[model samples]
Target: MDVRKLAACVLVAATAGCTVVPGSNMNRMNSVWFDDTPEEYTPAETDIQYIPINATVLAHLNQQAQKQPLSNAELEAAISSYHYKIGLGDILTITVWEHPELTIPSGSFRGAEESGNEVKADGSVFYPYAGTLYVLGLTTSEVKDLVTERLSSVIKRPQVDVRVASFKSQRVYVSGAVKQPGIAPVTNVPLTLVDAIDQRGGLDEDAAWGDVRLTRNGHTRNISLRSLYEQGAWSENILLQHGDQIHVPRNDADKIFVLGEVNRPQGLPMSRTGTTLAEALASANGINESKADGRGIYVLRNTGISRDENNNPIYTATIYHLNAASAVGFMLADKFALTPRDIVYVSPAPITRWNRFLSQLLPSIVATDRIGDIQNNN
Candidate 1:
């Protein structure tokens, strides 16, 4: 070699130390190495629970699914028993038997008579005999009884009927990932979870149906839309109250990201039935035949923190491994659920890893040589 070429080789060797391997450097950059003794904020592999994806793990998860807080029937009964209360801006139509003059105005000049009385902001409506009776915070039945008692003094046993002509008082808000997100007016018709959702024009294509959040009063509850529809967990369809805010979160966590030696490296959103490991692989068109290390298929999950049995704080993630070289491994993949935001990585074969290292390393090395040649030519 020429003196200049030898110097360039020496410089490359010195700058890129012999101990510095491309794989280790890339792993560090990717934060893939899990240390036993992790520094603060750096998660340790020991902190993570490593589980082999198998029938036993799948059985355990299936067992947990059986323990529901409320059944579908119970939820339906509770939500169905709800009664509507009168509120401000409600238009009430009160009918007094044998009193057409009092109920419906019949002035010939005005074609149709204005019969409905609008409940004012103060929560009371005006009538011929009742005269601005307090109706706010009262149910339709309660208002009818009150009107009956008030008119009894004027007319002897005056039969009275009260009905909501147009309900416009209370409203529930439906927002986020809905086709038409806005306030849905609560009327005489009892507004249930289903009603509010339908009023807002149902969920968008990108909606995270697995987790629908409902905020009522000061508290919030997560309702699974998937459970309600697919699993027939009708109890999830709870009654919505006034001032309630229903937000359907976007399927932002809806995707399971596939990386490494997969045929297609992309994020596949969970289907309506929920995504499984096998399904995610199928969406990505399975692993690369030549380059993939089927034995090294891993699912990385960050499960947040929790208290151990000793009451000590334990941060944990779950790294699930699957060796898909066998038929049983493929079956296990089908059973293993791929939760939202999960990272499904297919590690490259040993030969492929070397190719990857060289692929990344060669470009920089070539670029450096090109610069050196340009300077030499000048």
Candidate 2:
């Protein structure tokens, strides 16, 4: 149990290719920061790559980001039409010219909605001359034509105009990261994606643009609302249907984790626009200058893994090393984009590792030396 003997044994075990204490593995991670072996850079040969952050890689990544995700198409296709039609429980007002007795007029106190004919659960609305007629799937214009034809038999050249007095049948629900999260009615004039969002008071300040979710019929799809406005990708503004749900998700998922030797290591959420590597480091109060390795700042992405067919976990992280020691390195960091779930790791300097090791090991060595001196005195 002597401290010197334990240290000697650990040194021996590590050299003998045996498993030592967990702390001994610190050097293994140290290998990732500074090791410049050429074979690892080869895509076909190695599992992990060591890509230096530079102009070329930044441009490529930025271009790839501009290409919207393929899932947007499926979301757009789900909403085939934006046309509005009559549905059960909807109030319809039919106005007749020069027919005061026949048409139930709204009084000074009563509104047109109060005198309107409501589509019953059976999808039928009853009128004076039209009798009981099914109006489901019929638009306001079509309903007017049908009512005028029925009234023509009673009154010659019956002038009739039909409109939706109240919309109470179909609805599009909006929630999450919006100024007003509530239901937006599907009106006689077709409601598109933008209309529903505007009706709910637009997106909230904390909302992420690309994270707009549209859920319908138990299927959920994502569309980038930012593209609609900024990039002029008008295709994103697809039609919304009855029973459709729109949610502008919060930017929680777009946060990046700053770990290791940063002054204030924490998860930083991205803005509605975006967050670059420079911004992320700035938010973390930059790296610890005294202890951090200037050449070892890394951005590790896709650190997540999927299991192979054999049930073995597979890691395919694309790591980008940034040597802040270089003059242009900080400029490159400004250009590098930080995506959601990325890890910005600033590895410790060699002196830092030595200092930490001595901090842990010196106390035991000192106590043992004191005990030895006490025994000699005894």
- Give each model a TM-score: 0.78, 0.79
Note the residue pairs that clash in candidate 2: none
Model 1: lDDT equals 0.79
**CA lDDT of 164 in candidate 1?**
85
Q: Provide the lDDT at 366 for model 2.
A: 75
Give the poorly placed runs of model 1, Cα more than 4 Å off: 1-46, 108-113, 306-315, 354-378
The lDDT of model 2 is: 0.79
* Candidate 2 Cα misplacement greater than 4 A, ranges: 1-27, 30-50, 69-81, 105-109, 226-230, 252-254, 303-307, 311-316, 367-378
lDDT of 1 by residue, 1-378 (tens): 544576567557734543333452212233432446645564433376788888888899876764554466755675577678888888888888899887777763332214688889898899997877999888878989999898889999988888888778889999999999999988766788888889889999889988899998789999887867766667678777799999999987777898878889998878867888999998899899998888888898879877767766777788898989998998999988878889998877767766655676666667777777887898
C-alpha local distance difference test of each model: 0.79, 0.79
Task: List model 2 lDDT by residue over 58-137, tens digit each.
Answer: 88987876675434565455455445788989999888889866667435456789888999989999999779888998
